[model samples]
Target: MIDKSNQQSFQRLRLNLRQLEVFVATARGGSTRAAADRIARSQSAASTSLADLEAALGVELFDRIGRRLLLNESGRALLPKAQALIDQAADVQALFTDEYAAPLRVAASFTIGEYLLPSLVAQWTQLHPKSQIQLRIGNTSEVVAAVAGLDVDVGFIEGAQTHSDLVTRPWLADEMVIVAAPTHPLAGRLATAGQLADATWVLREHGSGTRQIADEWLLKHLGQVRVGFELGSTEAIKRVVAASDGLGCLSRHAVTQSVADGHLVELQTRLPKATRKLAIVLHREKRLGHATRDFLAHCSGVKQ
Candidate 1:
């Protein structure tokens, strides 16, 4: 049913999945050997496939710097397309196997990854038992970078962090609470601005989303406070605050259990309630695979 010109155009397709696979692996791993190791092929074969792909496309996709093969402008432009194609092909293969296809790569900030996602991920896995999900945990800034750099299919983060290359949607509402050990002087009474400003605090480190919000809230309410310990892990901050007389400001979800167990007490402060928005982030051009779309819908409580 095709015309001569259309038939000829169809016949001119020279790109193959194997070549694209090798190209993507090389771009991610930065070497032919690494790509070969990923795809279970010889180094020479990987190199040849990459070379053939470039020759067919009539452009160099990578710039060789010493021994590393970094993606050039052309390669960067083609990577998302190649990744999408590979994922779609896997989906096709999974059709006959009765399994979900394509590994879902997700990144999340501390609070969401620690307190929120575990239950959600468990529920998702119950529905899609054969699906594979990989999660990377970092602070909000790192989560934004991962999504923007195309290293993850989607990201969940806390706070109002935004990037030009990502689309962010508000996912959940969270509250920040100030806590202290049960025996701490301020634990049983309302904290005055002067007392809060004079107290020693154990807080999250500088770059974390919790720290950013805590800084803004505390500084607005009680000028400057003495930071006794700056820890990276929220659990560590909780433990340190419980053992010492210092206080911690953290997500309510993170501290509720401890407060209920009587290990930590929520401080009754005069400061206004501190609330933050947790968000979902994704690269602007990244195509969502079936599993990812389902997971997002599940998180959003959308019946899709």
Candidate 2:
């Protein structure tokens, strides 16, 4: 255990608030000019602040390779610590500012963000109205990465991940159902693994968690299907499936309305159910704030 005096000494060695702020901004924005614009500081001032921070720490934070500013080894090593310090500082500021200070920053994948999280967030806000909530929606991989990198306090993702830096807890179960338009030739037919291999498939983009699961399942059962198109959004995939002869694998939640409205028909297949474990992920070393903790508890079905 670190002694309290040693902890204080280490804190003393940390960059001051202004320098830390500038460092974090530059690291996130990928350039001094972008950081300056974000923080309302001049570009020269941002650059000077970063230089002063590196000089004080005796390490170089960024390497100027061509036009881009990339984080060096030292920068990568210090980034999480710097971010933690900033989060702690924000907590300190919040402590003195009445009851609540700012919105909780959350990142979530497309399906969860679009189909599931609205009710949960609404309930959370009703209980803690003073606590604001900001959400960033992305694909599953992006959401997982955002939480692991401390870019957001928490993330809701659609599938299991093995990232060592993150602590993942099962939050929900999502089913991936294979579906096609009612007018498609395969609409009423039961598909065998061999039959599915011959049909054209509309797939999600590369980094989407749904896409990863779909691909893995396909590889395990059908080896490789004939892909007709790759789409980025779930809605777009649904539209393409409705208009084309291609079949699609999508979250059951995503196409519930379409299925009910007779636009799409779920195909019964010989393959096993493609159920995915949706997870709530957080940085392993980060402490959760009140609002963040509250949200997690709600998702976990634990009453505060």
What Cα-based lDDT does every candidate model obtain? 0.90, 0.86
- Lowest summed lDDT across 10 adjacent residues in model 2 is found at 94-103
TM-score of 2: 0.66
* Candidate 1 local lDDT, 1-304, one digit each (tens): 7799988887897889999999999999999999999999999999999999999899999999999999999999999999999999887887647546457899998888988888888888888888778999988899999999999999998866658888988888889999999999987899999999999999988878899999999998899979999998888999999999998999998998899999999999889999988889988888887778889989888321
Best by TM-score: 1
**Per-residue alpha-carbon lDDT of candidate 2 for residues 1-304, written as tens digits (9 for 90 to 100):** 8799989899888568789889889889999999999899999999999998999998888999876789999889988988899899888897548444467889999888887787788887777776677889999889988988899999998866788999888777778999999988777888888889999999898889989999988889998878889988888999999988899999887889889999899998889988988888989999987657767888677321
Instruction: For residue 294, give model 2's deviation from the true position in Å.
Output: 0.8
Error of 1 at 274 (Å): 0.7
Q: After superposition, how far is residue 133 of candidate 1 from its true place, in Å?
A: 1.1
